[model samples]
Target: MPPHVLAATRALNWLELVTETMRTALEALAAAAPEWLIAHVDEEWFERYARRADDYRLPDGDTARTAFAVTVGRDGIALLQAL
Candidate 1:
């Protein structure tokens, strides 16, 4: 597997765990950051990135490819997983 694939998988797994354990996406962000809110990403932006990723396929070229965007509201903090 590509290095980025492994990283993406890890991020996805973490997100799943957060969502599962926290119940609400908002809750997950709060649990992880205690002061933030996060929600589903904008569909248009996500799809645009997905298209680019399919053509370029640069491992870890962009954040979206590594993990689905979680719209961390003003309350949330940026959580970047170790790459």
Candidate 2:
């Protein structure tokens, strides 16, 4: 598959892995930090929350797992808002 397709696939997978409530929270996060999704065209660094071992708690007291994670060199970002 192509790079854009791969990124889209990985992003969908991340969204699918979470619950409805978590998905809403993650969407908000994604909207706030668009740069977190940017990566090199040839890079393959997306991973699930469990394997990444990153979790976070929202202000509403709900927990969110690591929906997706990626890094381009030293600028790494993780979406820890999908349970």
Candidate 3:
């Protein structure tokens, strides 16, 4: 498989794990903040770059392709140890 595909697959797998583990909590969050569940991306930019576009740019120059968005509350943090 291509590198991008592999990366996406890994991300999706991790997403599945997260959603499964926190189904109840996620459901409540979805009810309270539905917008948080929406995926973040620039449609126009995505049209040009497709999956090749980096969704986020780090201060250190690294880039990230986020499969989706998850907005935990202001003081909330979600961390995945391994995926």
Best by lDDT: 1
Clash pairs detected, candidate 1: 35-75, 36-75, 36-76
Off-target runs (Cα >4 Å) in candidate 3 are 24-68, 72-83
- Residue range 1-83, candidate 1, lDDT tens digits: 99999986776555444433323443344467643332433334223232222323433434753343353221123223210
C-alpha RMSD (angstroms) for model 2: 16.4
Better of 1 and 2 by lDDT: 1
TM-score of each: 0.31, 0.24, 0.33
Candidate 3 worst ten-residue window by lDDT: 74-83
lDDT of 2: 0.35
lDDT of 2 at 57: 26
Extract clashing residue pairs from model 2. 65-82
Q: After superposition, how far is residue 46 of candidate 1 from its true place, in Å?
A: 24
Q: What is the lDDT of residue 38 in candidate 3?
A: 34
Candidates sorted on TM-score, descending: 3, 1, 2
- Give a tens-digit lDDT track for model 2, residues 1-83: 89998985565455444433334444454567646543321123322211322233211211222322212211222333211
* Candidate 1 Cα misplacement greater than 4 A, ranges: 24-83
lDDT of 3 at 61: 18
